[model samples]
Target chain A: MKEYLKRIYAMLIYLFLYAPILILIVFSFNASKSRGVWSGFTLHWYSELLKDRQILSALYNTILIAVLSALIATLIGTAAAIGIHNMKKLKKKVIMNLTYLPVVSPDIVTGLSLMILFVFVKLQLGFLSLLLAHITFNIPYVILSVLPKLKQLDKHLYEAALDLGATPLEAYRKVILPEIMPGVVTGMLLAFTLSLDDFVISFFTTGSGVSTLSITVYSMARRGINPKINAISTILFVTVLLLLIIVNIRMSGNHNKKER
Target chain B: MKSKWLSFPYLVWMLIFIFIPLLLVLYFSLTIRTPDGLVFSFDNFRRFFEPIYLKVFLRSVYLALISTVICLALGYPMAMILAGNNFKRKNVMVFLFVVPMWMNFLLRTYAWMTLLERQGLLNTFLTFLGLPPLNLLYTQEAVVLGMVYNFLPFMVLPIYSVLRKIDRQLIEAAADLGADQMTIFRRVIFPLSLPGVMSGITMVFMPAVTTFVISRLLGGGQFTLIGNLIEQQFLFVGDWHFGSAISMVMMVIILLSMGVLSRYDKEHEGGGLW
Candidate 1:
């Protein structure tokens, strides 16, 4: 009875976690305009999404910001991680806390601060500023994700590479890079995910002409909850779930191999 | 020589990007915007203590506190199970928990809108079961639900990390001594996991205190949190000074909580993020 109860509890929590998302997925295919009942399954909304210029443009904007922000964040974050890793005399704990500020700082603070910064500098509030703000937060995510790997790496591999007639650049390229590639990949993926999903900072920094998918979704949903929004949300939910599954499979496979 | 110059670029970036902007916010928080563009005054800080703004601040704290408790209630058992179970399905469970974090939070809250709105799925399902339709959206309840859903994984992940590191023999010894399951959990598991609980509470509470979008979108903008008030000051009212003050107040609350948690961790766990 105890075991049965525990199983039931687990199943119940799982259902609770997933039921809303699954409902959204199912209704995204409803044929009727009303969200009241289960209509016949149809691909109409998906097709409509393909032709909706504003939605497409917002998606385009999100992609643009995610790509640019992730790239910039990856570079800066990798450098910070390497620098912190090399600082043997410094207090590791204090540096870790400082590195965490960007991640843990309230988005409202980050957004407001960036907005005020751009205003003071007279920089135009648009894609570029959004890109800068996104990168700012994204850098810390990368740094934290990559730091553990850097800490675990063998220092003598680089030393050996240099001892074996390799230049500094070549030693780093041939030895250090491969050792840290897993963390780097994970960091880049995390940065990309964060940049794609961020709304508060984008809302504050986005100018008149550019807006992200999240902001567009917010405005549309706020005006009135509609089925079209469901359509977009369903697509987002499925895409994220699938991407995560693939990433996990790859990560777990690597982890299992290392354990063996 | 060139390597020495490399530090200059990073230092310049930090000063220009982070430090200067934060100092400006600090300055603005201590000033008032007048006809002369700006004046050094404490009016903005003083104004935050007014009843209406203070109520908003309290409401935000209350909401965050409630959400943190809920996340803990839901997250702890799950974390314990994940840490203790060497089952094949553990990866799948972990994947389920973390995958939701990848979806945009706004989109997830909007999904709640579909579920909770009048004439929406929940009400429709209710009517189908020979029951009356229930309107649940646009309430504090809905806002808290949105927050828990968004932050549960944050709570779970850290707790699980800490739980996984705990020595299994301790639990076995407790069981071998004939301690009941509940007692073992309370005496063994709970105390050991307090670090994660503190981290999780900090994680859930900080974001919950300042969350504007979920409350605005899911709570119908009726229940204003500190974050919503801050956003309103900047966007709708065009009062940057007031907004900066609210932002600073939030920063202080978060820093105080973090400081307390870190000090506690130092005394207890020898200091770690978990």
Candidate 2:
């Protein structure tokens, strides 16, 4: 009886979490615009969703920013993690705190301050600023994930590679890079997800002409409910679900390999 | 060694992006642009102390606190269950908990809008059941619901992780002693889980307090939380000094609370952003 009750409890929580999203997904296929009444199924909203120029551009912007920021943040963060791993105690602590500042602070402050800095420097607040903001927030996560892997690495592994007559760059590329590859990959994937989901920071940093899918959705949502958002969000949801599954599979595979 | 040169580039990037930008915000908050020249003053913060803005500040904190409490109440039991020794399919259950989080945050919150609309599913179900429909949307309850719904995962994930890490031996040993299940849980389990609970509170509270979107969407623009006030200062009024001042105040509130929380978090587990 106790076990049955536990199962029921878990089920109710899951129901609460998933029911709204499932409803929205179901509505995306509804032929009629009515939200409460489920009309006959049709793919009209998804079809309409594709032809919408503004949403398409926003989608393009979201993907472009997410991809570019993830790549750049991974590169910088991995290098910085290695360097920090070799640092003395005090210096490491200071750098870590500096790293945590952005991570810990509220998004509004980060967003607002970045806006002020961009305007002060006369940098345009469009795609470039948006990309910069994403990269800025992303690097800390990448650094954090990468640092743990660096700690696990055999500290002498690089020296061994060098003593074997490989140059420093070659040693780093062949030895250090592979060892931390899992962390780097996780960080990159996380960065991509965060950039994809980010709205508040993007809302402030992005200017009039260029907007992300989030910003577009916000404007549409503000005006009231639109079925088009449902269509776009469904596609986004599926994409993210697939990504998470791929990452999960890959990580578990790596774990099994490590066990072996 | 020489590899430390690699961090040089990142340090430079951090200085430009993190340090300077925050410094600029501080500068804006402290200074007023007069006709003659920019002058430093506390006028913005002074104005913030007025009752109208104070009410917004207090409301933001009060609502965020309520939401955090609700998340804790709901999430704690779920975490305990998932972390329990007899729990099977733990990994899958945890994964299921995370799956909704992978959905877009905006869409997740917006999902509630569909359910809470006057002509939406909740009312439809109510009518079908021969019950009175609720005017659910555009209310304080809706905003609090949105916060709890969105941030529930943040609370659960941290607490679940911490509970998972608690050694089973400790509980077994407590049982071997004179402790009952309730005693083992209260004396052994709960204390060990404080770190997770602390981090959970911070994670949920910070976001809930700062959120402008949830309040704006669910409150139907009727409620002006601190976030809305700050956004309006920048968006419409173009009042940077006042906006930046409010932002600074928000940061201090968060920082002070975090300091207090971390002081108690001796293990320092799961507090930092992952």
- Taken over the whole model, the C-alpha lDDT of each candidate is 0.82, 0.91
DockQ of each: 0.52, 0.78
* Candidate 1 lDDT over residue span B1-274, tens digit each: 0122322343455566666778888988888867887789989989999999999999989988999999999888778767867456987777777776787888878878888989887888899999998769999999999999988888989899989988889999999999998999899988988888898999899988999998998899999999999999989998888899989989988999999988877866884444
Question: How far out, in Å, is residue A167 in model 1?
Answer: 2.3
User: Which candidate number has the best TM-score?
Assistant: 2
lDDT tens per residue, model 1, A81-184: 77667764555566666667766778888888889999988999988888988888887788787778877788787778878999977876788878787878
Error of 2 at A214 (Å): 0.5
Clashing pairs in 2: none
| lDDT (tens digit, per residue) of candidate 2 on B1-274 | 4688888878999999999999999999999999988899999999999999999999999999999999999999989888876666878889989999888788988888888998898999999999999999999999999999999999999999999998899999999998998999899999989989998999999999999999999999888899999899988899999999999999999999899888878545544433
Candidate 2 CAPRI level: medium
Q: Which consecutive 10 residues in model 1 chain B have the weakest lDDT in total?
A: B1-10
Question: Considering summed lDDT, which 10 consecutive residues are worst modelled in model 2 chain B?
Answer: B265-274
Interface root mean square deviation for model 1, in Å?
2.6
- Runs of candidate 1 with Cα error greater than 4 angstroms are A91-95, B1-11, B271-274
Models, CA RMSD each: 2.5, 2.4
